[model samples]
Every structure is written in C-alpha cells, then in structure tokens.
Target: MLVNKNRSSAGFALPTVIVASVVAMMLLLVAASASTAIREGLYAQHYRRLAREAAESGVVLASKCLELNNDLAQWSNSAKLRPNTDCKGAVVAGRTQYIQQDGNVRTTFEVGEPERREGSIQRITAVGRTELIRTTDGAVWKSYEYRLAGQAGLSTLLDSVSFGYATGGGFAMSGAFFTVIDEFGRPRSAGFNGFGQLGVGSTTDTLTLKQFNIPANKRAVRTYTNFLSHGRNMFALTENGEVWGAGLNNHGQIGNPGQSVAWVTNPVQFALPSTDNVATFVAPLGIVTFVVTSQGNVYAAGLNEKGVAGINSTAATIKTPTRVPFPEKIRADAHSWALDSQTAYAIGESGAVYGWGNNEFGQLAQGDINERRAPVRLGDFGKPGKTKAVQLAFDGDTVYIRDSAGAVYSAGKTNYGQAGVPTFRLRAGVSNRCLAAVGASLRTENCSSTAANQKWHLDRTNNALQVESNPGASQNRCVEATGHNGEETRMRWCAWWSGGKRFDFRYPTNSWSYVYLSNSTDIGGRGLCIIEANSATGDTKMDSCEYYTHKVYAPYNPTLEQVASSGVVDITTDQYFATMVYANGEVKTFGLNNGALGNGVYVDTSNFDTYKRQAYNPTPVKFILPPGVKAVSSWTTSNGVDSKNGNTFVVTSDGRVFGAGSNVTGQLGIGHIGGGTNGIYPTPQQMLVLGAQGNLASYVRSGYGTTVVYANNRKVFTVGNNSNGQLGDDTTTTNPTPRANKNTNPQRHVKFY
Candidate 1:
C-alpha cells in the first residue's frame, strides 16, 4: 500500500483521501456487527426471564381469583379491560413490573384462562411483550412480548376422603342418616328417617327445604356432637349435649341410662336421677346426658352379651339406664364410638379408648381379636406415646385417631388399608415358641431376605429351613415375596394378607387397600379436607375434588310426588359436594366413600333441603395431614426409590408443603398414588410406582397413557401400565408389575411423579 501524499502545499491527493475513507468505513462495519451480536444475546436473556416471571405472575393472579370466588368462576370468563387488573384482568395481591434496560425497548404481559381440576390448580397462562426501544426516526422505544402458562397440580395423589351410607331408606336421624346439605352449602346435619336429625322431632322425612324449619338466624349455633353407629343403628349427640338414637337398638345403642333395652323414639334423655314417684323427672328437656338412662352420669343399658354393661360384673341385659362409670377427675376430653358386628368401642376423654363385645378383626385394640364383656382399655394413646389425641374416627373395623401433634394412627382390620399400615405379617423366623410370641406381641419386625428361593421352617424342628421345590413360586414363573407364606413351590412373588389366610392373591382390581366405590346417596358432594381450624374465611378449612363419572340424573320422585312440577320447586343436578370441615370437631360427609377424607363434606341429597345452591360447598373432615403442612400429597410409594430427591411432597396437617413431588422411579416419596389420565386421583395419596431411588417418571398424557415414565435410576417405571416398550424396559413380562424395570434407563421416562 502506498500513501498518495500530495506534493501540493496543504493537502493530500483525492485518491489518498478516498482510500482512507474506505478503511474507516470497513472498521465501522466490523464494530457494528459485534455490537449487534451482544445486543441480540441480551434480548434473548431478557425474553426468557420475562417469560418465566409472567407465568409466575399468572399463578399469583389465579390464586387471588380463587380466594375471592372459592371456585374457578373468576378465571372462567373474561373480565373487562382495566388498568390495574394485571394480565388476567383480576386484582392480585402482588405487584408486577415491566423493566427495560436497553434503549428503546418495551415489554408487556397478557393473561389467559385458569383450569381447575381434581382439587388442583391445573394451569395458568400469561404473555409478556416488549417493543423496540429505538425507533427509525432516531428515537428510543423498546418493544417485546412474552407468553407464559403454569399448571399447578395437587401436592399429593392419594384419595384422602371416603364415604358410605348406613341403610334404611330416606334421610333419617335414626334410619339411613345420609349426610345432607345445609344452608351454608355444606353438610352440617345428616338426613334421618325422622325429624331427630331434621330438628322437627317428627317421624316424617322432610323432602323439601321448606318442610324443615329454617331459623331466622342461620349461624351454626350448635357445635357437632358425637355420631355413633352400632348394629345397623346410628346415634347422634347434639350441641346442647342431648343424645338421639335411631335405627335398630337390638344392641341398645339408644337405650335409657342404667336400664336395659329401654329405647327412645328421637333425642332421648340419658340418665336423669331416678325416683319411685318420678314426679320431678322432665321429658324433652335440653339436658346433656352422656348415659342413655343414667341421670347425670355415664351409664349402660340394652343387651349385655358378656358383662359389657359396666354394671360391675352384671351379665344381664338392662332395660333402663344403668350407672357405669364416668371418671369425674379428668375432663372427659373427646370421645368416639364404633361397632364391628356385636362388639363396640368407646374412646374416652382421658385419651383412653376402650372396647367391649365383639372382637373380630381385633377392633377392640387390645392386642387380641377377642370380644370383651365390659369396656377394656385399648391403649393410652391411639398409638404408643402420650401425644394427646385431637380426634378419633371409626369406619367399620378401622379406627383412625390423630393426636394433637397431628400424627395419624389406625388399627383393626386393615382389609382395605383403612388402618393406614401394611396389613401383611411376615412369618419368616417362626418356631412353636415364636408363634406363641407372635400371638402375644403386638409388634413385629422384618429380619429376613433372600436373593433367590427361600423356604418357611420351624427353627426347632430342623437346622435348615426347607425350600419347596420352587419356594414362593408357581409352576415355572418367578415371583417376589409378599409377606405371605414363607414356604412355597417357587419363590418368585410374595403374598400380602388380604384380611387373613386363605385370602392372599394377586389381582389388580382388588389390589388397593381402599377401593373406590360409587358416590354416596346419603352423603353427596365432591371431595374435600380440613386444613385448619378457626380459619378467618369461615369456621372450617376445606378443598374440593373432581371425579370422572357418568352424567348424573336428578331424582324423579320423592315419596311418589313430582315436587318439581309444583311451585314448591326442587332443582336436581349431579355434582359432587366439595369437602369442608368445621373447627367444632365435626366431620362433614360427602362424595364417594372410598376416597373422601380431610374435612370432606356433602353438597346435594335426594331431599330438597339436603342440597345447597351456593357456589362454594362444604364437606366432611377429610384426612388429617401432619401439622405445619401447607400442602398434602402422595408422590411416592413404600419403595425406598421415592425418597423425594426434590421430587415428591408431604404436607403437615397444618397445611404446609414439606417437599416437592419428584419421581424416584415411577414412585414419589411425597405420598401420592400416581398421575395420568387413568392414574390421576382427586385426593392426595401415596404413589407406589416401582423403580430405583431418585425422581423418575413419564406419562403419556392426562388419561390416555401414551407418555411413559422411565426412572432416571437405570430402571423404568410406567404410569397407566405400559405393557410394551413404552415403559422402556427390555421385558414385557410384568403387566401391571408394581416393580421397577432395572434394565431400562430412568431419564427418558417422564411423568408428574
């Protein structure tokens, strides 16, 4: 390159000037390209960040909407444009800001609909926009937009609520006793055959809301008393402390105090002082009598099968209230009553639950399945410790009791896992003496393991346990041991006790401890649970559940009358009642019986007065979670693989979320069953996917079971039962095999595990 320096006195030649200008232009072009690349990178970063923020903002917005409306109605329809409505056009508690650091750039967020399902916040969508900060006219104005959406599912997958009907047609205080609707859109009272629970004190069933007297003041003036079921009959305690018995009293669940077989029609007086003349005795008085006929004391009456009358060794049936024993030294805390065939239990105030009569399934909790004649102490606490009991509930043979500390304990016949523990008892190390201990000891431990076939043997009889040709096996297939018989033909699978011996088998339909049944005709509503007490929003805490079911049909007739035809109209719609539980120690009943828990309540009934039209409904007390739990869910199974490496979550009964719902294999330790179109549940329960430890799961879709869940732990687990390669395992051997496929990779299998 040669410089054309001019020979002229003052300046260089025009050519030289032109060359210098060209070089300068080239440098400018290079610098501009570099600057453009940096700017583009910055823009991309901002866009991603804004998108995430927008999605989070949408969730906050949706929560605010639900707070005000209790249902998804707020997010269901579009709202008119307003300045402060955020992206969803709803006012939220949090503030959102759009920032622009670069020159001449703009960003905005747009909101979309909210999808609520299965007691969960399924999805929320939002958009963020930004405009160019600099204009063509040399002005600065940034322009950009981003859209984000969020889907918040339930914390757990286990069905916490369960419900069932008592029998005897119609809503009755004594008969049937369906959990009916109340004015507040919750299940406050049970429908009785008579006005006992109806409050009219009549035998006629009130089919219309008008038939029942609606007090001018609709506040729940009466707290939930006690509800007892025995021998096909149901007994209820009122806020005024009065006792009402209905149904059959063949066992004397509703008899008078100190007497045997003395039955009352409706709410009857329990033990008042007895006098020969009896001129001072009062009837239909608002007196609280714990004893049926004994005045001012705890008494027993009716049939005394085995000296259960508490009459100090009396074996005869008393027709009147008989003085038993009501310890006055300690305040009679809370109490609960349940019956299994001819036996019953009365959990008392001092935190002591007692039992008598039948001993089937060991419901008496006396470490033995023997019927008692009198009330025998079951245990100090529902479990082993001194933790005070918060509440006690009974469902058939299962008794559920939660302590003030929020630990749930259950015992009795866990045929359906209502007892909340593994029902199988391993009989590995057994001898004649060991069998004796097994019969006496209430606790047991698992101390045996076998890589291949193991056999059952008596340690005393032989030095070596004999392995049947194929111990724990059938013909040619291998199986895992299920805590069933130790000695078998080929040890390939285990058998868990299904109530007792001779009932151990592997069948999917009956695999689950608690099976889902039909919706309750007595207690009708969606599922719900009680999360807190003294809630400012209302007297209780609740959540709602959605179920996939056939279209519901309205009741066509009530007592042979087409009530809808008359002006005294009754509306019939088929929707499950949302669950809600009151602070007054009352559990509202609702929805399907198998999955309803928490403070789950009922919403609708065949009786007109049984239905509440409010947008928000109440239910009975669902499953009580561990306290301090903001959220409750079942994200894992009993397998060790689901230890919540930030995959699963468990909420304390107090409504706090402890961990995330991460999948370890297909199982999550957070305690939910599973998630899929066919696997997803309305209530929170524990998940039992089989695979190695660590979060690993993949689902096909909501219900279809396309997307499979392969665990990240070198094992594959499938939700919705992938019988083929969808589960990613080499073998298609385990159809509905609730075990991990160790041969497959775990990362590829993705699910909401």
Candidate 2:
C-alpha cells in the first residue's frame, strides 16, 4: 500500500510520546526500590543496637556472679533453666529477656558460666538476640565476651545479705544484687520513692536496676532499715565500716545535718568521726544509729528514744553524732527495738555484760524496770560461774542470757507466757491489790509471794488462769466470773467448770499487757479490770479495764517482741530464738519459743488459751547424731515479720548438719515434713548428712523459709522453700527435698558465700 507523508508524521509523534511516559515510570520504580532497602538497613541496625545493650546487661550480671565466688544459682533473677542456650562448649549461667507490647519486638541475653584462669581473670560469654518478627531473616543474634578479673593481689570476696522488716519495701546490701525481676526475667530496682530508699539517684521510681554510684574503692557490706521508718529510710555500712546513708533523714538519722527535703535519692557517705575506724554498729530501727569505734568508744546520733543513744540529752532528736558516756569500752554489742522505747546491752572488754536505756519489762535483769541513763553492769559474761551470763542477746523488751553452766535464762516481757515458766500475781494497776484465792473464793489482797494461792500461771494451751494451793503445788484452780459485771470472780478447779476459762491479753502501752476475762458478759473493749470493790481490801469484782495505767506487762511496740529483740543489722537479724551449740556438742534454743525452739514441746501455736505457749528458757534439742559428730555453727531462718516463726539448722564438726523446729515450710531440710501437730520435728533430725570427714561447708544462708548449702563437692544444694525460685535451682516447684544445681560439678555448696 502507498502511504502519504503527512499521515506518517502524525503516527510518529504519538510513538515518541509513549516512549517518554515509559522512561518516567522506570525512574519512579527505581527510586521506590532504593528507599525500601534503606528502611530495611535501619531496622536491622536498630535490632542490633538492642542486642548489644542486652549483651551488656548480661555481662554485668556475669561479673557479679564471678565476684560472688562463682556461685551463679543464688539469684532471684536467674534465667529459667533452658538446655543449650546459644553456646556449644559453655554452659548457661544466667538469661533474661525484654519484650515490647505483645512480644512484637524483643531483646534477649544469655550468660555463659564463668571460667576462671591464671592471673585471676574470668572469661564470660554472653549471647544477645533481637527479633522484630519470628524468623531468622528478621532476627539479629550476636555473642559478646567479657573478661572479669580481680585486682592482681585481691584475695577477698564478700557475698552477703541483710534484711529487716520495715514500713518500706527495704534496702539491699552491697555484696548482694537486690534486683526484683519482672515476669520476663528482666530485673527491676525501682520501688516507692517517697524516701529514696532505692538509692537510684532520683526520687523518681524507675524499673531498671540503676547502679548505686560509689567510689570505685568502696563496696557495701551491710544494710540497715529503720523499724519505725514511715518513709522507708535506709543506710549502708561500707567494707571499711564507714556509714553511707540514703532515703529518709527526718530526725537527722542519716547524719545529714540539713536535709531540706527530709530524704535523699542517692547514698551519701555519713559524716563519721575522723579519729577512729568503726568496730561495729547497732541499728535497732527508729531514729537512732549507734557506732562503736575500734577503740571501744561508743558514738550515737538521732532521737534519744528512751535515752538509748546515751548522749545524756533529752532533745527531740540529735542532729549530730556524739560520744555516749558509757563507762567501759566494749568488744561486742546488741540492742532492743522500737522508737519511743529501747534497751541496749554491750559486752565489755573485761567480759562484763553491761546494759542501759529502757527497762520497762526488766529485760536488763537488774531486779527492776527503771531505765538507765548510762551503762551499768548487769552481770559478768564468759566468767567461770554457773550464774554468770556468758552470751547475751537483746531484743524487744527481753534479753536472752546464756550462762557458762549451759543454762539459758530470758528476762523480758512475761506477758502471754513468752518469757517461759515464771508465774506472777496480777496486781491491780489502780488498787495495787493482787488477784488471790482466799479459801476457795477470789478476793483482792495484798501482793506477796507468801500468798501462795495468789501465784497465777497462764495456761498457754488455752489462755486460762492456773492458781495453785501453793507456788509449785500439784493442785491447780482457775479464776472465773461467778455472775454478772458486779459479782466476784469464782475460784474452781480448772477442769471442774466446763465453761472454758479463757482470758485475753491486750496491749495498753509499751509495757502493759492488759487482761480481758473472756466469760464476762459485761465485757469492756479491753477486759474486766478487777477494780476496787470498796476502795479497801477490795472484794474481787469485774469492771472495765481500758486505757488506764492499771496493769503489768503492757505492750505498745507494735512489732513482734521476739523479732525486735533478736534483730541485728550487720548480719542476719531475722532470727527469732538464740541458738547455741555448746562445747559438749549439744544444741540449745533459748528466747521466745513460738514453736521454733524444738524442745520436745511440739508447739502447735495455733491460738487457744489467750495466746500460744512460748518459752525463753534454754531447752535442748534431741538429735540422733553420729558418734563423732559434734556441733559447730548454727543457721536460723526467719524474715522477722512474715516468717517470724522459724527453723534451726546446726552444723557439726564432721561436715554433717542437723535440723529441727518448725517444718511447715519444710525449712528443716528433712526431705519430708514431720506429720505432727504443727508439721515440726520436736526433736532434731539429720538433714544434710554428708561424709564423716570435716568437709562441711562453712557458708550457709537462709531466707524466709528456705535454706541453701554448698555441700555436694561445693555444688549449690538448695532445700526448703523455693516458691519464688530463690533457691536458684532453675525450677519454681517448691519441693521440700534438696535440689542439685544445673551444672553441678563435684563440690560442696552453701550460700551466704
């Protein structure tokens, strides 16, 4: 066909326009592809950065593990045990993970077991991973290495913990990592910031376990929490024995002269005296802090609190630390609890046990309840006499005294029978007349030991009164109400009247434990006080006993008396009873029994006669130990608040351990709990039975109701409560039986390492 030239030109222009459009579309496609690749690279870098941070956290924790003598399983935040996590030759020591909402984005780290080498260097491996999507193509993984080595000549490692019941959550000791981990195994150090007790550098609460900045040369050794601290005040003692305080300072308790805000978020080294190094510290809560210098001088600061500080001033609170006028220099010391009340005991360099301060319950055993302004000799200790006190423990309103002859005596609040077997006569706070049995009838008579019928002992099993024909007589009678409010108390054989003679004691003050007769119909809120019937030698009658200075043994310090008395801030203050392993290989418990005493009196303690039976008298714990086994040290378990009732474990000279007392939490390490009235072994049971050789590990630690020991070739062996994975056995199961560590090699292991 023939084509015209004019028609060919029009078709040629349309083809050129199509080619131009195609070139623009290709450029746009190329630009879009380049932008997508850039975004992918950014995402990969972001994940990698997160992985790096996780790896860093793991290495820090691993370094701590090395510092703690290579014991990796004693942490509450230990990663849940997983087999073969990111290492072929190395075993996993710790693992943790962080995740963003619904686990869409996550970062994780796993620490390998530390390997010790020459030059004191430790090799640590950490595996870090991140994921935006659940696929290898969208994930990042990396391994980071860390070398943890001690100073060339360093030879000491301190792994310790200090705990006390306080209004706030609590403070952590220096050697232990007090990290509260989240459900994802991520550690959190944040808590209530009202008083800055966490020492995280700000009053603002943060979840990350922030570092407590201190001098590189200084390390924390002990933690102290004020028993009456409303704002959660706390302080730490350094390895050099200098005080470093944090949190609330409202009474200048932290030695910060002008804390305008009344607290600190960061720890500040205390303004200690420049002259001497510290020998020890006594912090029984409240506002006072006592420091005993190595030269044996006593210094104190903060609230006098019954003159316990011994500064001879009655000021509201001592703003500066001052030396006390105590007579003699002391080697060891202990004190009582409470803010408005206190008592302190010290063992003089001459072996005399001296006491001062509040004596509301005759806890100082000076034959009276008068508060001492300064130190006074209570008795001699470690002397060569049966009556002399050899060892002493002061807590609450009681003092536990152990004699050289092996007899134990408790002097303190006998209210509710906590002071053990001693019986007393109830003297009317108003009339001064004592409750006495006048020829089978109850009457208010003059208080006297000669009034044999007046001696009344509490039936701890049922809170009933037991009056005897004479003191220590076999015949017993109980006091009860004959009729209504205006009638006399009826005297009947304890079993003659089935009405169940029950009486309750209530606290009216720091020293008065008031009584309430349970059967009285005209019951006042507290109890029917036997007020004067005629203002003369009053005929015993029931009347209202409330808020009056009308009784003996009043209790006002709201915490457990036993816990207050037995506490020490430097070491484990959670112990309830005073346990001693005699030189003769016998283990004895003295102080408030509360079923933890293991003295063949299976204390069910579940209430009843007014209160549970308790004993402060020293009692023996029977154990069927091997012939060569002789007692050595003792470890007792208690939180002092929630776990006030406790268990006892005794280490023998032959590397074996004997356990006794309450087993409700299986804290006795007996494999199986005793099926008794209170799930306790009234007698001691051999739990940690090892070789007959003296290979027993010396380090043993107990928390709440758990016990940990390094016995099987030094590999960590955990027994007792594991409800929170605190045993570090990689399991949450609370099996009473002891658990072996994951990479448990041949070694003996016990914590408090």
**Alpha-carbon deviation at 734 in model 2, angstroms:** 7.4
**Tens digits of per-residue lDDT for model 1, 1-753:** 987765696667889999999999999999999899999989678766765554455555554554344334443346621224643466555544443335555444555566553333345565555555545684535444455555543221111110112222222433222222222211222223332433344544432221122232221212222222221333333323444443334444445553233233343433334441111111110111224322223555555655555554555655565555544211232334433234545555556556556554455655544456666665565455675544444443445445554444444433222233322122211210100011111111221222112212211111111222242234222221122221111122223222111111111121222111111111224322111122222121122212211111011000110101111110100012112222322222222222222222222212212222211121223344433233322221111111121122232223222221223223222333334212322233343442224444321111112112333332333332232222324433223323443222211210121
Residue 506 in model 1: lDDT:
12
Best by TM-score: 2
lDDT score, candidate 1 = 0.32
TM-score of every prediction relative to native: 0.34, 0.56
Write model 2 residue lDDT over 1-753, tens digit each, in one string: 996577765565767888899999899999999899999888777767776666655555555544344443332224421123322223445633342223457666665455443223344555566655545565444322222222111121122222222332233421111222121211123333445665677665433344444454565555555322232555656657777666666667666565545667677666667887573564534456666667887776666667676677777687777877766676643322222236666666655666777876556666545677667665545445524444565435556555445554555554444443346556555665566776566666665535567666666566566775633334577776556443457666777644435654543332324443334333434346444454385565656654554433231111112222221211111233455555666655553445555565554333323232333232333434556677766665542222233666777766666766666766666667545555767567776434334335554555445666655344445666554344444444555666643422222221110
Output the lDDT of residue 666, model 2. 68
Model 1 stretches astray by more than 4 angstroms: 1-165, 168-202, 209-252, 257-268, 274-297, 303-316, 326-350, 380-386, 404-408, 423-753
Worst 10 residues of 1 by lDDT: 553-562
